[model samples]
Target: MNQVTRYSPLDDLFRGFFVKPMDFPSGMPAQQIKVDVKEQPDAYLVHAELPGAKKEDIHVEIEGNQVSIRSEVKQERDVKEGERLLRSERYFGQVSRAFQLPYELDEGQSSASFKDGVLELKLAKKLAQPASKRLDIA
Candidate 1:
């Protein structure tokens, strides 16, 4: 006799679930996210691809020791009782990313903007601290 373990319904619902209708402003998740980092001697420019995403729908935040990027995509969906949905495939939800840098950066100088479905981020590197001279006690 073989017995199948009962799994959580939560797992099964995901199998064929389309974008669930939600009141959330941004109805879509990170549809397609791509990040490009340009390393320079003085700074690092990070660019992210947010296709079908809007500037107002995205938010960027930085903490003392962390940098976080988040955004949402929105869409519309309709349903009719017992109606067959021909086809649909669109991801909707909040997307986030974070990264750490070796050198300190000037948070005040950070800037972000969206252009042609791409997010451009400009970060200015904090100036290196001068080495402190050590004096031996006489």
Candidate 2:
């Protein structure tokens, strides 16, 4: 005997309830901050692409071996005299990405630069040191 399964639309909707829906203009997907990490002998080099984002709006943070990057993009239009606005569109978005490396980073030595929509991070590795010390009885 063969068992039959029933088809339900509600089941499909509920199955992907937690997943975000993909919507883009003209079938083109939204752009994100693309990142590439290269591990060196004593440092890590990271290159991230943030299009249409200003350098002042980008931020980077490091915690232990984890690295987080956040950027905001905003677009505006200004109309001059004798120019009637037809359809105006303004876009504002925020994108963030976080990842972990094999070694911790030295915040004091690390440096970051942004140029031509590309962000470069030179992360220096933190030297390992003994964390525990001998305790004396009071």
Candidate 3:
């Protein structure tokens, strides 16, 4: 059996009037953080795009081989006596992203820098040691 689907432009228009844009069904505002990772011989490079975020509002945490990046963006606008807002697309909330490295990372040796709404992380790889061998019982 073949099923047919119907499209209605008016349905979307009516839905848009009642529902707020950027609204998620989960009720929690969605904040997505984009990131890129590159691997090098000695270290790994991570670049995260965080527009409208301040450096002081960004935090980086390293736990074992996982790296977590968290940031909050706040935006406020002052309206005049006779001003009104039509549409707003700016996001203002907390966003976090975590990544796991292929190898263990040296937390003490890692460095991070943020500039122009971009966060760059230089994660140093920990040296691999030989596994311990257990002695056989006599």
Candidate 4:
């Protein structure tokens, strides 16, 4: 059966305002890691958007069909003797996201790179192999 997908701008707007913030609890704001996954003929490309994060604060892990991306963001300012804070709205905390793929991934062949606050991962698909024979019950 053929399926058609629909795209809506309002959905994105509402999600950005509501759903994205819910990732943090107790009113403690945190940076949210948003990701986009694209599948090709032979591999999958994952693009994660992590603004205001340093390369050393990010970590990526792949196990079986699951892929996880985590990052920590820290922001601090030294106030002068006569300076007073006016307003601040930036978030500082750790955030992580995990997703599972339909196909097996070739971990050894997968590669990841980060630039301009975006992380890109190229995951190669593992070739399917026949399952081994099952042993009889004792």
Taking all chains together, each candidate's TM-score versus the true structure is: 0.63, 0.65, 0.72, 0.70
Which scores better on TM-score, 1 or 4? 4
Best by TM-score: 3
- What is the TM-score ranking, best to worst? 3, 4, 2, 1
Instruction: State in Å the error of residue 135, model 1.
Output: 7.0
For residues 1-138, could you state the per-residue lDDT of candidate 4 as single tens digits?
999999998887787685453443446555678899999988999999988889999999999889999999887876789888765667878889999999989999999999998999999999888899899999
The residue ranges of model 3 lying beyond 4 angstroms of the native Cα positions read: 1-29, 130-138
Predictions in order: lDDT: 0.75, 0.88, 0.88, 0.88
Query: Looking at model 3, which ten-residue stretch has the lowest summed lDDT?
Result: 20-29
CA error at residue 132 for candidate 2, angstroms: 6.3
For residues 31-56, what per-residue lDDT tens digits would candidate 3 score against the true structure?
Answer: 78899999999899999999999999
Runs of candidate 4 with Cα error greater than 4 angstroms are 1-29, 78-82, 131-138
Q: Which ten residues in a row have the lowest lDDT in candidate 1?
A: 21-30
Tens digits of per-residue lDDT for model 1, 10-125: 98878656666544454434355778888788777889987767889988776643567788877668888999876566666777788777677778877877899888887778
Count clashing residue pairs per candidate: 6, 0, 0, 0
Model 4 TM-score, all chains together: 0.70
What is the clash count of model 2? 0
Per-residue lDDT for 1-138 in model 2, tens only?
A: 999999999998799667866543544345577899998999999999998899999999999999999988887777899998765344468889999999989999999999999999999999888888989999
Residue 10 miss distance in model 3 (angstroms): 16
